[model samples]
Each structure stands twice: as structure tokens, then as C-alpha cells.
Target: MDPRCIPEKFFDIKETEVLVTRITGGNVRNALQDIHVADALFDLDELAIIHHTDCGTLTWTEEIIRSKVKSFAGKEHWAEIDKTVYGAVADLDEGVRGDVKWVRAHPLITEKLKKGTQGFVFDIESGKVRKIDV
Candidate 1:
């Protein structure tokens, strides 16, 4: 996770106030690896999904990565990576919508967190975060 994205300074929050995890959008949207979070945040209140401009996940689509990996990293390597979702986003608003939808719909997260959910778009150049209305 980039400090610039959810910086402690963003809300004048102390360092201990947040726990950041850097993952592909697919992980968020598909709810692949959230068991630990469900346990850890059992007493949590809210959640936020922040997708940013110029993310590496946006550099390549899952289809493109699937097609090219064999040639670039060999067949075995491609097989290992094939199961993963690239989590690429071509449109920020729509991507945020899908991510927020999934998060809201996730069975584990829905029950674990009870208060609020928000999505955001961070402008890499401006170092600004804007809320996306879901």
C-alpha cells in the first residue's frame, strides 16, 4: 500500500490508526482473501476501498496477461499465475462501483463490519482522494 494513498496525514490520523493492505482490485471484487480480515476486524466499524490512477493493475488486462505469460515466463510459470485475477481497471468510477458492490455483498465482510463502507479514487498526480458515490 502506498502511503501517499491512505497516508496517516490524509485525515491527520496517527500511524496506529490504520492497517493498509496492497492488493489487486480482483481480490477486493472477488473477495478471495478476506478470512483473516474477517477475524481481525470482528469488532470493526467501517471500511474503505481506494483505487488509484496509474495503478500497475491497470497496465495489463487479465486476458492479455494470460495470452502473453507463456511466451514471457514459460508454460509452467503461466500455469501458476493463471489462477490469479489481474484486477485491472479501465474506468475508475465503474471499477469503484463494482468493487464497492462486491465488498457490500461479501458474506464475510458484511457480517464482520457493521457501520459504513466507502470507495475512493486517488489522483496520483494531485495526491488527492475523492469519494465515489456507490
Candidate 2:
């Protein structure tokens, strides 16, 4: 997570007021397990999938990231590594929409949660977050 991309400050919210499941590219695919757990436990009011401008994931392809990791983690773990989603992003708007759509369609996320799900793009330059209608 980027130090400058703090949702609390960006949203003008208190630290304990929100439950954030932050991940690279803000991909809901990577946060499904956490979403499921939270859905089952908490009465979450909203699910905001926030992707930002100039994310590192935008700089490289998934294959390129995997190749670099393979060089360091060794081929022995390639199976697991290959299975992982590196979350390489292209367009910020498209990324947010895809994640929101994916999460809303996921069977594990409750219907209530899905209905409440929303997408956003955090403009790193402007320090602002805008909602994306899917």
C-alpha cells in the first residue's frame, strides 16, 4: 500500500470508523476471502473498491512480475506463484469496474453486500476519491 493513499484521510474519516481490506491495484479478486469473512461477521454498510492513478501494477504485465518473482523465489514455488494474481492494471477506470463487477457476482459475497458494493478511483495527484458507477 502507498503511504500517501490513506483512505481515512482521503475520506475524512476516523481510524476506527472503517474496515479497509487494502491490496495491490485494489483488486476485489484478491480480497474475496476477507470480504466473505467480513460479510458473514459484520454488518458492513459499504464495499468500496478503490484503484488509484499511477499504481505500480500499471507499470508491468502479470507475466513480467511472475518472471521476476520466479528469479528470486525459485521454480520450486512456481506452481503457487503462477496461481497467484499479480493484479497488473492498465486503465484505472476499467480496473475498478472489473473488480466491482467480479465481487458483486461472486457467490460467497452476500446479496446485501453485493448490492452495497461500489467502485472508486483515488486520484493520487489530487488526493481525491471519486465513485465509479458500474
Candidate 3:
């Protein structure tokens, strides 16, 4: 499934176990660390890291994006806009790999969780999801 579509559709089911985490500053590892620390009570069977094609987040550098926004809006708004853009531009593959790596490498999750973690790449054009060998 498309990563962008997951929240609106996959997460809509009431029975689904969802932990909505928004990691800012484009730091995937830091975000997962926070989740691991906070969500110890829940039973996490598998981790799904989804990335899509044609994602606007992948385009543009932090400085350029901020400058463009500031040009249109104002200099005072650059900081907030830069932070938001960075958060969204957090690479999907990197985020997924970091999360799974953390789960497998960390003593906390590895000790309690028996299921192995994996990553996937979703192609929006072909509508196919393939396992990513990282």
C-alpha cells in the first residue's frame, strides 16, 4: 500500500493498533528511539516502513525550501517552515531501515520480540510493494 495512503485508509479501522509518531528535524533514528522508549506497553508484532514515488518531500534542500517559503511568506516564518519541511522530507527508506535496524539491534526489543524485522519499498506507479534487501 502507498505510505501516504496508509494513515487515511489503513489506520481508519478502529481495531487497528496505531501509534502515530511525527518525527521532526528529518531524523529517523531519533524518532524511533523516542517511540521505543515511550511505547513499551504495546505489543508490536511487525514494523512497516513505507516509501512512495513522486513524493514532493524528496525534492529540494532545507535552505532552498526555507528561502522560497520566506520569500513568499516572511523571514519571521522561516524557522517554523524549515522545521516542518524537514520533518516531512524524512526519507521513507532511511526511516524504515533505521526503525527496523533499531528493533533488531536494540537489546530491549530484540530480547522480548521474537519476530524478525524487515523493510519494503512501495512503487506508486506500478502499485506494487517489494521487500527491500538492506
Candidate 3 deviant stretches above 4 angstroms: 1-4, 7-14, 17-30, 68-115
Task: Give the per-residue lDDT digits (tens) of candidate 1, residues 8-48.
Answer: 44556677666556566424654435534654756456667
lDDT of each: 0.67, 0.84, 0.56
Give per-residue CA lDDT, model 3, range 25-59, as digits (tens). 22445556655754575656555555555665566
Worst 10 residues of 3 by lDDT: 1-10
Using lDDT as the measure, what is the rank order of every candidate, best first? 2, 1, 3
TM-score of 2: 0.91
Q: Candidate 2 residues 31-55, lDDT tens each?
A: 8788767766887768888888889
Clashes of 3: 0
Question: Which residue pairs overlap in candidate 3's backbone?
Answer: none
Candidate order, TM-score descending: 2, 1, 3
Top candidate, metric TM-score: 2
Error of 2 at 7 (Å): 0.5
The candidate scoring highest on lDDT is 2
